[model samples]
Every structure is written in structure tokens, then in C-alpha cells.
Target: MKSLLSLLLASLLSVFSLPGLAQTPEAQSLLASVLALKPNAERGEAEFVAQACSACHRKDGSGKSAGNTPRLSGQHGAVIIKQVLDIRSGLRHNPPMQPRVTEQSLSLQTLADIAAHLQALPISGTIAKGPGSGVARGKELFAKDCAGCHGANGQGNQATFVPMVAAQHYGYSLRELEFIRDGKRGNSNRAMASLIKTYDQDDLLALADYMAQLPAPQRK
Candidate 1:
């Protein structure tokens, strides 16, 4: 009986852990690029606020406490650069950023500079989604703050800077929201920054759950 139980547990653990352990080379490379980023605070921060990133993100980098916009402050530099590249090159899937890009409101160089800056800020906290009340509140907040950009189902705009928030890690998402709110992660779209500004802690956590539940983005 004991041998059978041990075997069962081992199998389960392997099934669960294989993906993380067997990350594709591409995945490892991409993650490595993101992790290697280092922020040039003085230059980057100045660039961040000057680029009008502060308008919607607020002066602190915390957004409106709601919306589909991502937080950038204190984020990995690699992630910021990757996202900026996506937005500038029209690789971002989120639909909303296309219009702004068309207007040349955010230039590719500006995106890079801002991305470098945002990666320097500190990470923020997320609101927890408890068993009962937290879930309900999270839903309400998601509807009010995140639906338009994130979609009701958290199917984010993939073409633009908007990411597919669903199925993301909660801690990552939580910190991401904080960066957006603080102007560390956003600014390319003033409208998005405005939307993100509405979120608070609890609202952020709820958003994380909603995002985590979403389907992962399809490979191109």
C-alpha cells in the first residue's frame, strides 16, 4: 500500500512539474532576456515622466486601480523591452494600442527609453481574492476597471501593448498592475494609463485572478 501511494505521488509531481522543468529553449531564452534588464534610474525615470507616462499612470506608477493596462514599475527589464518592441513593431495583439501607434504618439525609441526606466521601479502588492467576498468583489472591480481593455473574459488585445492577462501568475500580475499604476510600465497609450489609474490593492488581486483564469495566448 505504501509503495503504491509513493508511486502515485511521484507521478503526480512529475506531471505537474515537467513543464516548468522542461521549458523549451526559446522559453528559456526569452525569460533570460527579460531577467537581464537593469534600469538606469536617473535617466530612465526622467524619461518616464517626460514621456507623459505619468499622466495616466499617476506620478507614482500605480494606475487607476482598474483596467486592462499592465503595470511596468519594478518589472523585469526584459519584459518591458519585449512589450515595447511589440507595441512599436505592431506585434502587440491588444487592439487598442494600434490607433495610438498609428498616430505616432509613441515612437519606438521612446518606448525603449521608457521601458528601461520602468524596469527600475519597485514592485507593488495585489489584492487577495478570498473564498467568498473577495471573489465577488474582484468580479465587480474587473467589470468596472478591466473589462474594456482586458475583455470580459480577460482576452486582452494581443496586437497592441495589451497582453492576454488570463492564465498569468497572480504575483506577477499583481506586481504588473502596480507598475502600470505608477507609470513604471505604461505611457504609450494615455488612454490606457488613465484606465489603469483606477485600481487599488483588492481590485488588483481580483484582476490577477481574472487574468490567471484566462486562456494562454496562442502561439503565432
Candidate 2:
């Protein structure tokens, strides 16, 4: 499994060289392995707490906005798995998460379990929002630029690995948008980066605000 994971990491690195490319064979294999595992949410909850994830993400998975941490509650399990694997493989540059998301600390099964647990959690608690001034423009911008891929309601496509941005904190969203625009976020989708690069700071602020104000998706 470790060898397989190593190969997966190499495949992920190749993405940096070929943006918008299809997944490599090794990446597909790792995804299959993760999908094959029967995630144990109960065990995941324990690991979430034990791994000190609760410290930043909160016990409920409503992440800290002041810290620029994103809300993880109700996110798709596959998306979570992909991001964590990216972090572990150095495809994503998250220094704080790097230590905790190591291969030894989170094996594929444990990672899958954690993702399931987080996905099952309800998205509750107060989300930090942007100022009201830009909401109208933000809404317009969202319709014109973002709604196609992210959906009209920002309920991201789980199968495509697009994260649910509705109800996310404005501060975090703005920061990440800036990072993607500036090419600072290594794992960002190239198309998104290019599109966001066209936006000014105020556009980003409005976009983030609009996204933050969107209602959270109703979970079954």
C-alpha cells in the first residue's frame, strides 16, 4: 500500500507539469483503493479528535474563520480524500497541515474514514461573512463567472472534486481566491487560477462575499 501511495504521489506531481490533464494510472489506482475501503465514521470521529483536528476545525468540523481555516463539515468524502492526499504528496502547500496529514499518520483507510465522518457532520455555527457593500456585484459576478462549474447554488460537484463553496467563510474564501489568482496555491485548478487572475481584489472580495452568503445545501 505504501508503495502504491508513493506511486500515487508521483502521479500527483505530474499534474503540476501538465495542468488540466487526465489522472494518471497510478492516481486512478489510489482512488480505486480509497473507494474500495468501507469507511468507518465512528473510528473516524475518534481519529479526528485524537489527531488534534478538533483544535482548528472545531469538534463539529466548522472550521475557524479567523485562522483562515475552511469549514470541513458536510464536504464530500472524495474531495477531502483528494485534498489530504495532495497535502501529503506536496502537491498542495499547506505548512500547518503537512505535519498532521503525513502518510504514516493517515493511511488510506483512516483517511477515508475521517472524510466520511466529516461529510456526515452538519454544517452549523456562525460563518464569518464579508461586508454587505459588494453583495449585488458579487451575485452578478458569480452568475457570469463561477456558476457554470460550481453550480448556481455553489453546491460543488463531488464526482469532479469541486468543493462545496456555499456557506464557507468569506475571509477564508477571499484569501484562497487571492492565492489562486497569484499562483501561490500549488494545487489549485489551472482554469480557476487563470479565471481568477483576471479579477481585481474587489472582485474577489465580492465573489467571496456572495459565496459566503449562499445558503448551505440541505443534507439528506
Candidate with the greatest TM-score versus the true structure? 2
Residue range 1-220, candidate 2, lDDT tens digits: 4553344445444543466535556665676578568889999999899888989999999998783699999998777998887788777789999989897877898898899899999999888888978889999999998888788999886656678999999889998999889877788887888889899989998999899999999875
| Per-model lDDT | 0.52, 0.83
Q: lDDT of candidate 2? A: 0.83
lDDT of 2 at 120: 91
**Native-to-model Cα distance after best TM-score fit, residue 95 in candidate 1, in Å:** 4.0
Q: What TM-score against the true fold does each predicted structure earn? A: 0.40, 0.88
lDDT of 2 at 85: 77
lDDT of 1 by residue, 132-218 (tens): 435566677778767876677665542222444544445557666776677665333445556667766777676666654454444
Model 2 vs. true fold: TM: 0.88
> How many residue pairs clash in model 1?
41
Question: What is residue 123's positional error in candidate 1, in angstroms?
Answer: 2.6
Poorest 10 consecutive residues by lDDT, candidate 1: 124-133
- Candidate 2 clashes between residue pairs 3 or more apart in a chain or in different chains: none
